[model samples]
Target: MNSKFRALTFILFMAFLRPALSQSVENAWVRRPLPGMKLTGAYMVIKNDTNKDISLLEIQGPDAEYYEIHTHENIDGVMKMRQLKKLKIPAMDKVMLKPKSFHIMLIQIKKGRLTKQAKKTELTLIFDNKVKLTTETKLSKGPL
Candidate 1:
């Protein structure tokens, strides 16, 4: 009976602690689509509160036909957009995805996906550890 009680206690403890172990998204927003533009950008701040590093695998949303993790690199004095396979967030640290740095590229945006008025969009962030986080973003004029 003592062992069963201990197991139950452990389970309850983990259940309450699971959320703290996951990555948290903050300041998530997407750029307003320009006239006849098929591509736009999304920015956010991701915080990993867990003890272990987290790998960002992919991002998906219905606002765009596809999405990719991208970073700007200076190659030969020219800025280039490089597609990142996985972005790592160090334990107890935050990674900022912003313009001219690490950001999410929304390619082939669906027509009328965005408007002058801010609208909330759903974004699914997939991690290498099989953790999926669904975050909402408000369409904005720019990263700001």
Candidate 2:
């Protein structure tokens, strides 16, 4: 291939990777569960610093046996949690996962995972472009 064509291809590839590279997870925290409770919720703000949109595919972590993206909606005057297949983060914007809204459901937490000294959990968020972001979230009593 010619040098001009090679340069154009490189530029296009970089552009494709820009949005995935610019995305970041901020202010992530998992609420402390009540005694004898094995389930809890986590919240965070996903910031998109790029000029293009991005989507979150799924989440995985060692703290819990199961993790799901969930949101609460009012159904017939009753609010209930609903699982989401994917969450979208708009271009140059932020998506916040908070209580009574979009958040992460952590089920069947690992035994003794939340110790006094270890007050944080590591979560890996997978995106549409196969980009994985590993973030450490501190434990909290409520939204900060």
**Index of the highest-TM-score prediction:** 1
Which lDDT value does model 2 have at 1?
Answer: 67
Global Cα lDDT for candidate 2: 0.88
Q: State the lDDT of candidate 2 residue by residue for 1-144, as single tens digits.
A: 699999999999988876454889999999888767899999999988877888998899888889999999878989998999999999899999999899999999888885555688878999896779999998889945
User: Can you tell me which runs of candidate 1 are displaced by over 4 Å?
Assistant: 1-19, 75-77
Model 2 weakest lDDT span, ten residues long = 113-122
For model 2, state the Cα shift of residue 29 in Å: 0.2
Per-model CA lDDT versus the true structure: 0.89, 0.88
TM-scores, each model vs. reference: 0.81, 0.79
Best by lDDT: 1
Q: Please list the Cα RMSD from the true structure of every candidate, rounded to 1 decimal place.
A: 4.3, 5.3
